[model samples]
Target chain A: MGIIVLKGYMIFTIVLMIVYAVRHLLFAYNRAFGKQKLYYNDIYSSRMPKISVLVPMHNEEQVLHYVLDSLLQCDYDRDRLEIIPINDNSTDRTRELLDEYHAKYEFIRPLHRDCPDRGKPAGLNDAMAVATGDIIIVFDADYRPATDMLKQLAIAFADPSVGAVMGRVIPYNANRNMLTRLINLERSGGYQVDQQARYNMGLIPQYGGTVGGFRKDLLLKMGGFNPAVLAEDTELTFRLFTNGWKVIYANSAECYEETPETWEVRGRQIRRWSRGHNNVMFRYFLRVLVTKHMNWKEKLDGILLLLVYAVPFLLAVGQLDAIALFFLHEMDILSGWWVLLFIGAYCSFGNFAPFYEIGSALTMDGIKNEVYLLPLIMYNFYFYMWTISLGFLDAIADLITGRQVVWAKTKRFTK
Target chain B: MASDHKRQIYFARTYRHLKANRAECALFLLLFILPCLVLLLLFYDELTWVMTNGAVWMIQQAGGPRAEISAGTFLPRLGPAYYAVLPTTQPDYSLILGNLAVCLGTVWVLSTGPRKGRPVAVYLSIMLLIHTMACAFFLLGKDLMPYTLEDFSDLYIKQQIGIWITFLVLIGLVMGVLGRGAILRRMLTVVSIMLYSFVLGFVRYVLFLWILYRFSVLYMPLMFFALGPFFDFLYFVAIYAISTNGVIRIYNTKKKGDWVWA
Candidate 1:
C-alpha cells in the first residue's frame, strides 16, 4: 500500500507539473503571436475620476523620497489628484520626509500611524478612510512611477466593470548583481507574458499590491482591507473577481521599482510572499469553485493562480517522494509511457516561470544580452523550493494555531 | 530628454510585436525534429560506442579501479549498445553506520548553526538527506536494492540519448517559434547547443563512473537524482540565451523598425 501510494503520488506530481508547463507554454505562445486585448489607454475623458495615490511606508526612509518625488512629477490634474504617503509606525526619517513633501505640495498628505496595528493592509485601511478620491492607487515606498503613470492606471476605472488596474513593473537596478538580473527576468516573464496573456484570454489578471489601483468605494463596501491578511492584494483580487468586478492589466502603464540584490533578502521576500499568497489561497480556493460570478475558464485559471505559490512546496515534496520510491526499488513507475511523463515532469519541475516563457518575454521586451542570465534561474529553483515550502508550513501553522501574520518587510538595497 | 529618448527606443523595440509565422514554425520543426530523429536512427550505436569508450579511458586514467565496457540491450527493438560496467560495492556495516553518523552530525550542525536559512546549507542538507536515505536503505533494506552499477550505467546511457533527443526538439521549438533571427543563425544556435550537450553528456558520464568506482554504489541514487540531466539543461538554457542575444543584436542593428506594433 505504501509503494502504491508513492507511485500514485509520483504520477500525480508529474501530471501537475506537465499541466503547468503546458499552461505556461500556451501563455508564451499567446503573448508572442496572439492578438493582444488592449487596455483602456485611448479612452480619454475630460472629467477624470478623483484619484488618491497611496504610498505605504514602514521604516522606508532610504527609498521614500524617490516615490514621493516621482508622484509630484505626475501629470494628473492637481484638483483631482492627492498623494497620501501612509507612515505606518516608521521609526526612521520616513515621517519627516513625508512631512517635508506635504509642506511643499498642497496635494501631498502624510498620514502618521502611531498605533500598534502596523502593516500595509492596516495602513491602507486607515488611509482609505480619509482619502477623498473615488479611485485609490497604491505604490510601495521604493517605486518610482513615471510622470503619466497615474493617468494610465486611472483611465481603466473609467469603465465601470474594471475594479482594479495593474501596471508593468520594470526593475530599476537590474544590473546591480546576478540576483537582481534573475529577478528582472522573472518580473519580465511574469508581467510581460503571464499577466498580459491572462488578460488577453479573458482570464484572471491579478492586481499586484503595488503599481495598481481599485475603486475605493467598492473596497470600502466590502469592509475595507483586512488587517489580518498579509496578502491584501491577492485577497482583494479574489474578492473583486468573485463579486463580478474585473481586474484589468495595463501593460503600457510601466513603473520602475527596486528588486532584491542579495540571495538572503530575496529568500525572505519569497518566503513572505509564499506565506501570504498561500493564506489567501486557502481562504479563496473553495470560494472560487462555488462563486457564480466566475465562468468555468475564470474559475480554473483562478484556482491555478491561487495555487501558484503552493507549487514549489508540492514539487519539493514530490522530490522527496521520488527518492523514497527509488530506495524502495519502485522503478516500475518509469515503465512504458510513464518514462516520457516522468522525464517531462522532471524537466518542467523547477521555476514556475519556464524557460520558454521567460525567453519569449525577454525577446518581446527587446532585451538583449540579459537572456544569458536565464539559465541561472535553476539555482533559484532550489532556493524557492526550500523557502516557499517553509512559508507553506508557516501558513498551515497560521491556520491551525491562529497565529498573527506579521508583515515581514523585504530588505531594501536602494542605498 | 536623454531618458525619454532611451524610453522611446525601448518601447519601440518592445511594443512592436511579432505575429506567429506558421511557415517559420514549420521550418523550425523540420530543422530540429527531423535531424534529431535521423541522428537517433543512423548513429545511436556509434554515439553510445563513443560515450562508452570515453568513460572507459577516463576511468583507466584515474587508476582507481578496473573498468570494462560491455554491450547491452535496453529495449530489444532499439538494438544492442556498449556501456561501461564497473564493480559494485555494497556498503559494509561500518561504512553505513559511519555515513549515517556523518549525515546526522551535519544535519545537526546545519539546523543549529547560523547557516540554517542559507542556500548552501539547504543544498548540503538535501544532499545529506539523499545520502542518509541511501545509508538507511543499505542498513535496513539491503535486500530491496534494485539497481547495480551496471544497471545504472545502462540506464544513464539510455537517458542520455533521450536527453539529447528532447534537447534538440525543445531547442527547435523555442528558437523556431519564439526566437527572431535569420534561419542560419538559428540553425547555428541549435548546432552549438547540440555540440555542447554531446560533450557535457560524455564528461558527466565519465565523472559519475569515476565517483561510483571510487565510492560505493551508495552514491548512485545521488548522482542519478541530484547531478543528472537537470543540471545539463542549465547550460543548455545558457547557450540558448547567448544565441538569443546574438539574434536580438543583429535584428536591432539591421531591421530595427520592422516590428509590428501592437
Candidate 2:
C-alpha cells in the first residue's frame, strides 16, 4: 500500500515534469522553426490608431518624471496621442509631477483620483471612463519606453483580430546587483524566447500589464480590468483569448524597466506574481482546456502556461514523497529499471531549469559571457521554489477560505 | 533546366560517394560495434560470474512475487559457460532486439544528413548520438543481471530513461545550435553534454535511472501511461522526430555552407 502511494506520487511528478518540459521544449522548437509574423520594421502604413497612455501611480514621485520625459519625446503624432497619468490619492508630489507634465505637453492629461478606491485596476478603470483614444496602453511608473515604442505597439491594432499588443521589457539597472542580474535573465527568457515563441507559433503571448496595450473599446465592453484580481494582465489575457481575440508579442518594441534590486524586493514581486498567476490558473485551467476556438496545441500551451506558477509547489510535494520513500525503506522500489527513470527525470527537469533557458536567451542576444552565470540559477530556482511554493499554499488557503487578496506592492530601488 | 539537371547529378554523385565512403561506412558500423564492445567490457566479468555461480542474493533480492523459469531456457548457461546448473529464466529476446534496432536507427539517422549544412548542427548532433548510444549501452548492460534472471525487472523502464536522456540532450543542443556565433554554440554544446553526462554519472545506474524518470515525469504527462502501456512505440517516434528534424534544421538554415558534414 505504501509502495502504491509512492508509485502514485512518482506518476504525478512524472506527468507534471513532462507537461512543463514539453511546453518549454515546444517554445524552443517553435522559436527555431516557425516564421515570425510580427517584426519591428513591418510598420503599418494605414491610419494610426489614437492611443491613450495610462500611467497608474500611487506615490510614484521618484520615477514618474523619467516616464513623463520619455513620453514627451515619443516620435508619435501629438494630435493622436493622449497621456493620462492617474494619481490614486497620493500624499507625495505625484500630483505635482503630473500637473507639471500636463502644463508643458498638451497630450499629458493629469487625472487625480481623490476617492477611496486605489490600486492599478481601479485607477485604470477610472481612466478608461474618460480615455478618448481607440487603444489604451498601460505602463507602470518605472518604465522608460523607447521613442518609437508606442508606434510599434499601436501598429499591431491595424490587424482587426489583434485585440492586444505586448512590448518586451528590459531592465536598465541589471548590473546593479545579483538580484537585478537574475531578474534580467528571467526577463530575457520570458520575452525574447518564450513570448516570441508563443507569438510565432500562434499560441498565446501574454499581455503583461506594463509596456502592453489593448483596444479601449474591447476592455470597456468586457467591463474594464477586474479590480479583484491582482494580475489584471493575466486576467485580461485569458478574457481576450476566450472571447476569440489575439494578443501579439512585439519583440523589438523594447522598453526599459527598473527591476527589483534587492532579494527581498524580488521575493515579494515573485510571490505576488505566483499568487496572481495561480489565481488565474484556478480560473482558466479548465476554461483553456474546454475552449473550442483554440486548437490542441494552443490549448495545451495555454493550460501548461496557466499552471506554470503552480509547478514549483508540485515539485516540492514530489520531493516530500522522495523523502518519505527514503525514510520508509521503500526505496527498493526504485531499483534496476526505475533507476534510469530517476536519472532521466533529473535531466528533464534540468533542461527546463532557468539556467538552461537563460543561457539560451543570452546566447540568442549574443552575450556569450553571461552564459557563465547560468549555473547560479540553481540557487535562484531553489529560492523561487521555496517562496512560490508558499505562495501556492497561500493561494489554496485563499481559495478554500474565500479570503480577500491584498495587492502587495513590489518595493523598487530607483538606482 | 540544364543547370538543374547538373545540380541533381551532383547531388546523386554526392549521395553515392557518401554511401560508399569507407569512413562513413566504418562510422556507421562503429555505432553498433562500439556499443557491443562497451557492453562486453562493462558487464563481461559480472555476467560470467553470474552465469558460472548463480547469485544467491539476486534470487533473495527478488522481493516481489517470483515467476517461473523454464528448465531449458538460456538464463543459467549464459553463452555455454558449461559451469553451473541449467535452470532459470532468459531475458526477453524481443526486448534485446528492439533496443538494438533503436540504438542503430538513432545512429543512422543522426549520421546521415544533407551534404551541405551548418557544421555546428552536424557536430552537435553527432556528439549527442555517440554519447547517447554509449550511455544506452552502459545502462542496458547494467540491467543485464536482472534481465537475465527475469528478476522483477522491466526493460521498458530502461529504454524510456535512455531515450529521454538522449532527447533532453538533443533538445538542449538544438537550443544551443540556434544560439549566436560558432564558438559560443560549440562551447555550449560541449558544456551541456558534459554537465548532463556528469550528472548522469554522479547518480550511478539505478539511482540515475529513477532520477531520469522523475525529471521526465515532472516535465510531461501521460509519460508513464502512454509510453508504459504502448511499450515505447511512441517514444521511438519522438526520438526519430527529434533526431531527424534536429539535423534537418541545419540543412534548412540559409547559412548552411559554413559547417562541413562530420
Candidate 3:
C-alpha cells in the first residue's frame, strides 16, 4: 500500500509538471508567433480620469526621493493628478523627505501614519479614504516610473470592464551582480511572456502589487483593502475577476524597479510572496471554482495561478517520494514509453522557467547578452523551492492558528 | 531617465513571421533529426565501449583491483552492450551505526543552527536526509537491496544513452522553435551541447564508479538520484544560454533590421 501510494504520487507530480511545462511552452509560442491582443495604448481621450498615485513607504528613506521626483516629472495634468506618499510608520527621513516634497509642490500630499495599524494594505486603505481621484495607482517607494506611466496605467480604466491594470517591471540594477542578473531574466520572462500571453489568450493576467492601478470606487465598494491580508494585490485581482470585472495587462506601460541584489534578500522576498500568495490562494481557491463571472478557461488559469506558490512545496514532497521509491526498489511504476514521458516532465520540472520559455522571451525582448545568465537561474530552482516551501508551511500555520500576517518589505539595495 | 526612451523599443517594436527563413528551418530540422539517427545506427557500439572502458580504467587507477568491463543486453532486440563491473563494498555494523549517528548529529545541528532558513542549511539537511536513509537501509534492509554493482553500471550506461538521445532531440526542438540565428549557428549550438554532455557524462560515470568501489553500495541511491542526469541539465542549459547569447549578439549587430515587429 505504501509503495502504491508513492508510485501514485510520483505519477501525479509528473502530470502536474507536464501541465505547467505545456502552459509555459504555449505562452512562449503565442508571444513569439501568435497575433498579440493589443492593450488600450492608442485610445486617447481629451477628458482623462482623475488619478491618485500612491507610493507606500515604510522606513524607505534611502530611496524615497527617486519615486517622488519621478512622479513629479510625469506628464499627467496637474489638475487631475495627486501624488500621495503613504508614510506607514516610517522611522528614518522618509516623513521629512515627503514633507519637503509636499511643501515644494502642493500636488504632492504626504500622509504620515504613526499609528500601530501599518503595512501597505492598511496604509492604502487610509490613503484611499482621502484620495479624491476616481482611479488609484500604486508604486513601491523604490520604483521610478516614466513620464507617461500615469497616463499609460490610467488609460486602461477608460474601459468600464477593466477593474485593474498591471504594468511591466524592468529591473534598474540588473547589472549589479549575478543574483540581480538572474532576477532580471526571471522578470523579463514573467512579464514579457507570461503576463502578455495570458492577456493575449483572454485569460487571467495578474495585477502585481506595484506598477499597477485599479478603480478606487470599486475597491471602496467592496470594503477597503483588507488590513489583515498581506497580498492586497492578489486578493484584489481575484475579487475583481470573480465579481464580473477584468484586470488588463499593459505591456507597454513599463516601469523601472530595483530587484534584490543578494540571495538572502531575494529568498526573504520570495518567501513573503509565497506566504501572501498562498494565503490568497486558500481564501479564493473555492470562490474561483464556482464564480460565475469567469469562463471555463479563466477558471482553469485562475486556479493554476493560485496554486503556483504551492507547487514548489508539492515538488519538494514529490522528491522525497521518489527517494522512498528508490529505497523500496519499486522504481518500475511505469515502463516503456512512460519512462520517456517521465524524463521529459522531470526536465521541465527541474527549472521553474523552462529553457524554451526564457529563450523565446529574450529573443522577443531584443536583449542581447543577458541571455547568457539563463543557466544561473538553475540555482534559483532549489533556492526558490526551499524558501517557497517554507512559506507554504508558514501559510498553513497561519490558517491553523488564525494568526495575523505581518507584511515584510523587500530590503532596498539602492544607495 | 534618458534610457527610458531606449527601453521603449522593447515593447514598441512589432513582430512579423520569419517567412523568408524557410531554408534555415529545414536545415534546423535536418540538423536535429540526422544526429540522433547516426548516433543510434552507427556509433552506439563505439560509444558504449568508450564509456565502459573509461570507467574500468578510472576504477583501476583509483585502486580498485577487481574492476572489469562486461557486456549485457538491456533489450534483447538491441544486442549486447558493454558496461563496467566492479566489486561492491558492504558496510560493517560499526560503520553503519557510526555513519547513522553522524548523519543524525549533523541534521540536529542544522535544525538548531542560527542559519536555519538559509540555503546552505537546506542543502545540508537534504544531503543528510539522503545519507541517513542510506545508513538505515544498510542497517535494516541489507539483504533486501535490489541492485548489484553490475546492475547499476548497466542501468547507468543505458540511461546515459537515453540522456544523449533526449538532449539531441530537445536541443534541436528548442533551437528550431525559439532560436533566431543563421542555420550554422543553431547547428553549432546543438553540437556544443552534445559534446559537453558526452564529456560531463563520461567524467561523472568514472567518478561514480570510483566512489562506489571505495565506499559501500550505500551511496548508490545518492549517486543515481542526486548526482545523476539532474546535474547534467545544468551545464546543458549553460551551454545553450551561451550559444543563444552569441546568436543574439550576431543578430543585433548584423541583422538589426530583420526584427519581426508585432
Candidate 4:
C-alpha cells in the first residue's frame, strides 16, 4: 500500500508540475516568440537564395502527384530551383509518376538510385552526392508543403552557420477523427512547446526525419544520410551540431504528411522510429558531445535528445512489477521506486512544458477540449506502445552486432 | 464639532454593520480553541469516556461495531486481499434522509453566502469533510477507542494513535479558518478540503492493492478510476433527485407558493 501510494503520489506530482507549466510558461508563447516582428519587406528580401528540393521515393504510387503539384507551386525562383526525385527499387508505378512529372517540368529531375533502395537515407545520399544547389531541402512522398516553405527555410539559413533548418510535419487530414485530432494535438504540443522551448533554451532541436533543409556543403561534409541508422535525418542533424554546426527551426515552414491512424500501424511506426533514433544516438551522441568542438549547451541538449524515448518501456515494466509484488506482499519498497519517481517527474515537469501545445493548437484550430483527452493519451502511450524498450534494444544490438538500422521512407497522404 | 461628531457616528455605523452576522468567523475561532477546551475542561476519565463514546458512535454508524471478538473470528473472514466494491447495505430511508439533509444544508449555506464562489466552496468543503470523516472513521473504528471500546488486540495501538491525530487535524481543518475574512476563509476551506483529499490519495493505494491482490495489472485501471462512467451515472441520479425534491422546494418557498404537493 505504501509503495503504491508512493507511486501514485509521485505520478500526482508530475501531474501538478504539468499543470503549473500550462498555467505559467504557456499562457503567452506568442509574447515570447511572437511573430518575430519582422516587416513585410524584410520577409521577401531579394537576397533569399533558391533552395534545392530532394525527395527520395519508393513504392509511393498512390500519392506522388499531389506532392509533385504542391512542390511545383514552390514560392521561390523557378529557374534557380532543382527538384531531384530519386527512385529506389519501386515495384509499383512510382517510376512512371516520376517520369510523367519529369516530362512535364524541367525542374523535376528523375534519377534512378535503385541498386540500394535500402532506405530513404541511402537514396538521399546517392542523389545528394550528385546534387548541384546551394541549399538542400528534403521532403517525403505524400508531402504537401506550403507554397512559401522555401522562403521560410531560406531566411533561416541566411545566418550562415545554420547547418540545417527543420520544419513542422502535421497530419494532412487533421479533422479525420478523434484519434487523428489527438495525434494532431500531440504533434502540436511536441512542436510548439517541447521543440520550440528547446530552440529558445539554445538546445539542439530534434529534426523530424522529414521536410528538413540543410546546407548542401555542410550536409556532405558531415556525411549526409549515413544509412547506418533508420532515422538518418535526425542522426545527421545532431551530428552537425556536435561538429560546431547550428540548426534553425522554421515553424511556419510546414509539410503536411500522413499520420498512422490505427494502433497497429502507429505502433509499428513508433517502434521503427524508436529503434532507429536510439541506434543513431548510440552511434555518435556521446562521442560528439565530448568532442573538443562542441559547446556545453549542445552537449547537454544531445543527452536530453537521447534520453527522450526511454520512459515508455521503463514505465510499463516498473508499473507491472510494482503491481505484482505489491499484491504478492514481498518486494522491497526500493524495488519499484523508479516507476513512482518517473510518474512524479513527468507529471511535474509536464506542467511547465508545452507538452499539450499541439493539442492546444488544434483546439485553437477549433478542435476544442483536445487538452482534456489525457486519459486517452495515457492509455495509448502506456498500454499500446513500448517504444523505449524497442529503442534500447535496437541501440545495444546495433552497437554490438553492427547491424545497420534500415532507413524507411515515410509515405505521404496527398493522393 | 458637529461635523466631526457626525463623521465618527457614520464610521461606527459602518463598523457595526460589518461586524454583524459572522457565523463563519465564530466557527473559525471555535475550531481551534474548542478542541483544546474539550481536552482541558473534562477530567481524564470523562475525557476518555467522551473520546470512546464518539468512536463508538462512529463504529455503530459504520455498521462494524464488534464486541469482544477473538482473533480467530477476524482474519479468517475478509478472506484474501482483493479490490471489491462490497454492496452498500444501509437502509434506503437513512441514505435518502442523510443525503437530503446534506443537500439542504449545502443549499442553505450557498443561498446565504455573500460572495460569488462561496456557494461552490461550501458545497465542495462539505463533500470533502464527509469523505475524510468517513475514511478516518473506518480506519480507526477498530482502534482501542473503538477496538478496546469493543475488543481487539493491544497491537496497533500506536497506529490508532496516529489515526487519531489525522482525525483531529481533519476536524480542525474542515471547521477551521483557511484564509483571512469570513467568506474568503470559507472558500479557502472548501478548496483546502478538495486539495487535501487529493494529497492523501489513499483511495488509489487501497484500490490498486486490491487489484494486485485479486486480479491483475491489466484490470487495474478498469477496476480503479473507471469510475468516470459510474460518477457520471451518479451525477445524473443526483441531478434528478435535486431537481425533483430540493430545488423545487427552494423555488416554491422563494416564490411564496405551495412548496410541497405532498
On TM-score, the stronger of 1 and 3 is: 1
How well does candidate 1 match the true structure, expressed as C-alpha RMSD?
3.3
- TM-score between candidate 4 and the true structure: 0.60
List, residue by residue over A60-140, the lDDT tens digit for candidate 1: 999998998899899999999999999999889988988988888989999999998889999999999999999999999
Q: Which runs of model 1 end up more than 4 angstroms from their true locations? A: A336-349, B1-14, B30-35, B38-46, B53-77, B80-82, B92-121, B139-144
**What's model 3's overall lDDT?**
0.81
Which lDDT tens digits does candidate 4 get at residues A228-327?
6787767876777777787766655657887865444555566677787677667776686678766786776577566455444444454454434433
* Candidate 3 C-alpha lDDT tens digits along B124-163: 6777789888888889889888877777787777777767
Q: Which stretches of candidate 4 lie over 4 Å from their true place?
A: A1-43, A320-342, A346-367, A409-415, B1-262
- The DockQ-based CAPRI class assigned to model 3 is acceptable
> What lDDT does model 2 reach?
0.60
Chain B, candidate 2: TM-score = 0.26
- Lowest lDDT block of 10, candidate 1 chain A: A332-341
How big an interface RMSD has model 3? Answer: 3.3
- lDDT of candidates 1 onward, in order: 0.83, 0.60, 0.81, 0.50
Model 2 lDDT per residue over A1-415, tens place: 8779886886677767756665666665445434445554466665788999999888888899999899888888889999999998889889997898888887789899998667788889999999999999988989999898889889888889988889889999989977677677778778777888788778889999999999999899999887767789998898889888988888878899999876656667777888888988888888888888788877877887787788878876765565455334343353323434543443344423433444445534534344444444544544676568777887887789877776656665784
